[model samples]
Target: MKVLLASPRGFCAGVNMAIDSLEIALKAFGPPLYVYHEIVHNKYVVTHFREKGVEFVDHLEEVPHGATLLFSAHGVSPEVREAARERNLTAIDATCPLVTKVHLEAIKYARQGYTIFLIGHEGHDEVVGTMGEAPEAIVLVETPEDVAGLTVADETKLAYLTQTTLSVDDANRIISRLKERFPQIASPPKDDICYATQNRQEAVALLCSEANLVLVLGSQNSSNSQRLAELARERGVAAHLIDGAGDIEAQWLDGVETVLVTAGASAPEVVVEECLDFLRDHYGAEVEVRTTREEHVSFPLPKELRAVSVE
Candidate 1:
């Protein structure tokens, strides 16, 4: 067996920043730290943090008063921020800059009296966070079918923003439908999908062209990771989205020759290496890294934690 690894596979800049911020905060502020959500949507990462004394909560009410809290990379709604303030929690935002850009755009469009149509999964952390920016003015649409059934007062005064991690081709198809229905609808100055998401998908698509089977390493809840597997399926190749090597089934590899290995932005590189090692040990697989793009992006730690001293 031969393994073809996708370039730009694991740990995008935003994920790196978010995870690093937590590690730094833990060192600086000490344990009992609270996070608004899974910092990057990977169970492995979350489990590691949990073992290290990090607390992940879905609601602000679960957090204790006057404690230090960190927002996830997926971002949070204004309501969440207000709730944190009400609880007197010292909060630090670890939202990716790209996701923050979309929130700002939503706020801007809402201020301009545009009814915003946000394209994203209904319950995704990022979608929920973005919707919180202007909940009264934003309507969520998850598919082209959703676009067809959408009802707005004035189509001309409409604008669209998308979740950062979405299927590239699927998003394009929905956008096309929206354009046909509302020609005057406005879009973001650039597509809201971030560079990391695009590059990972592109790398997987490139892998699909040659590999018979593709393996995407990420948590089930990871949007970009799911999109990689879906993209391969859309291209008529077999693909599986797995959290780690433990999730891989030997039956799926039967008759499979060239396997494409990739990871989501939030997945740690160790997971990829472990999966590779598993494949090699079991199947005598030869490995090669495929390069589609080179990424050099980084984000700084939150201001409040920058000067905090570690014990």
Candidate 2:
């Protein structure tokens, strides 16, 4: 068997920044640090943090009063911020700058009397966060068909913003449908899908062209990871989303001569290496590294933690 590895796979700039922020917080404040959600959508990453005394919570109410809180890279709604303030928690905004950009756009459109159509899955953390920015004015749409059924208060005054982690092709198709229905609608000045998401999806597409099976390393809840697997399937290639090497089944390798290995934006490269090691030890797979794009993007640490000491 042969293993083809996708380039630009694993942790993106935003995930790196978020994780570093948490680690810094843990060092500075010590145990019982509260995170609004998983620092990133990768199970392995979350588990590692949990073992290091980080506490992940879905609601702010779970956090004790006046404790330090860190928002996830997926970002949070204004309501979450208000809740943090009400609880008197020392909050740090670890939200990805790209996700923050979408929220600002939603707020801008809402303030101008436009009904915003948010294109993303219903319950994704990023979508939930963006929608929370202007829930009264934003409607969620998952598919092109959903766009057709949209009943807006004013068609002439409509705008759309998308979740940062979405399938580029799918978002475009849905955007096209919205354009057909409401030609006057406005959209973000540029595509909202993050650079890392776009790069990884494009890399998967490249892998699909030559491999029989594509394995995406990420948690199931990871939107970008799920999109990578779905993109391979859409291209008629078999794909699986696994948390790590343990999730790989021997049956999956049967009669499979070539496999494409890739990871989501939040996944660590170490996990991908473990998967690669498994394929090499069991299947005697010959590995080849493939590069579709070169990424040099980097985001600075959160402001509040800049001066925080880290051991």
What TM-score should be assigned to candidate 2? 0.98
The residue-level lDDT of candidate 2 at 258 comes to: 90
TM-score of 1: 0.97
- The local distance difference test score of each candidate is 0.93, 0.93
Model 1 lDDT vs. the true structure? Answer: 0.93
Clashing pairs in 2: none
lDDT of 2: 0.93
lDDT at position 207, candidate 1: 75
